[model samples]
Target: MIAVALVTGTLLFSPVLATHQVEVRGTAVLSTEEVIEAAQVPLGVPLTRLPRATISERISALAPVADVRFGQSLPHTLIITVTERTMVYQVADRGSFHWVDGEGVDFHQTAEQADGLLGVLDISNERLLRDVATVVTSLGPEVVTMTTKVTADSIDHIVLTLSDGRQINWGSAEKSAEKAAVLPTLLGMKAAWIDVSVPSHPAIK
Candidate 1:
């Protein structure tokens, strides 16, 4: 009876543990004010009673947030951590370019092109964009530095153009991890083209 009473007392009267401040971290593209606005954190609510999942869901609804986590600091503080999506490719539309993340989400648009970002030509299909992003992101840093552009007529017809005018027939997004693993060795050879479409039996010319 005494334990139950003590628990009830804590739940009912813990004003000192009520949330009074919110701190946001791990943000790069998003401002702390934007995250705080999106989170809609309930100030004055007891930290123990705050709906963590609900807060996370609200923050995740923001376009740039790829992932989010929530925590409570003792007494009166709420902590929010966020992981923003990275721009992997850019699609040109009517002379303007939009940034796309690895998940194929076009989250931002700009008139100026970013250095080292690959351009996606003519393809607007989201699935194809995702496939292109997958292949581009899976490549080793060395291979990525050599890549200049990615293009596709269809989902299965993905191609990568290297800085030295070499071409890579990446096939579909399937088996990308395997292809990425083997591509570096193939690039070392004196070949104008490399096809890792079928990673197990890659071809070079």
Candidate 2:
């Protein structure tokens, strides 16, 4: 068999045998349908002709897909596997809610109800929202569990609403670990809001 590279940055396969056989496969953390569709592979085509690198790039375009592996499965079969990131919070737009990954790329099916997921809103800055999403992803599960909504202000601060109707003051993405460390203790106290913006002294009011 002879393989030729195309100027369009794709691969081309010429049959050198009585039968042309190829297999491809990959794993997707959440779903593989999107990955296969993005590859734009025809129903009947040689596997070698498919651009593996280009296909991987297309799969990576998806927000949830963290890592994608593409390879041949057996004969005349293409397979794709994708690893998705964890869901930190669900951001709502208009009436639909979409799941935001750690990278703040919004994807996934929309939900009508808020459910147990935290809601992020009123973000004045895109960078801050992205940083907050990263912080939410890094914090322990309890942080996610306790948080209901995250609102961003011009002061580069985050205002969080807990499930218990208690508000929290999170200064910024910096020192999120330290703030998270005092979460259990703070939740134990009785107050309408907890201010953890100051690393040294976190107050409740």
Candidate 3:
């Protein structure tokens, strides 16, 4: 009992286990300095006294942060691993748009258009927004590169417009992988419209 109490007291009070360095990892668009600034971890504070939950909340408030995890590296370091959000497509909102990730999280907002991502137009509510995100993000690289815009009047009426002014009737978010797999072959044809809502039997016009 005495030994355990001594060890606990030493960890809580001594500078030997205090954090002197913060190591940031797994960042893409976020800089290490910005992550450190957001963490606000007090230097020379005992690791046992660290407010991990508060630190996580602060770092997560950053627009690009999807998830954050912390670890104590013994002696003098606090390690933070950050997972940044991926901008799958842009959802239009008047003059600007919000960026959505694969799981349908709207994480960032910007007025300027981004490269290599489709712009979603005519989106109404959160449900349809998530549905559109699912359909577009499930597409293979070949189909995604050719797509310029995605629009959905209703969940069942999702459509994709290619760069060459042609259209693809994507139906719903169901069977997205199959639909994406079949689009490249269908794109070779000079059809004005291609329907892969049911990939087993496609339609063209």
Model 3 lDDT per residue over 20-83, tens place: 9999999977899999999999998988788999999999999899899988788899999999
lDDT tens readout by residue for model 1, 9-116: 886458978899999999977899999998898899898788889889999988889999888688798999999988888888787887889888877677888766
Please give the lDDT score at residue 204 for candidate 3.
Answer: 94
TM-score ranking of the models: 1, 3, 2
Ranking by lDDT: 3, 1, 2
User: Where does model 3 exceed 4 Å of error?
Assistant: 1-13, 20-23, 26-44, 61-63, 72-75, 122-124
The TM-score that candidate 3 achieves is: 0.80
Q: By the TM-score metric, which is better: model 2 or model 3?
A: 3
Model 2 lDDT-worst window of ten: 15-24
lDDT by residue for model 2 over 71-147, one digit each (tens)?
56545566665677666777666777776677776656465744655556643345765776866766678767777
lDDT for residue 28 in candidate 1, whole number 0-100: 79
The number of clashing residue pairs in each candidate reads 0, 19, 0
Least lDDT summed over 10 consecutive residues: which range in candidate 3? 116-125
lDDT of each: 0.86, 0.66, 0.86
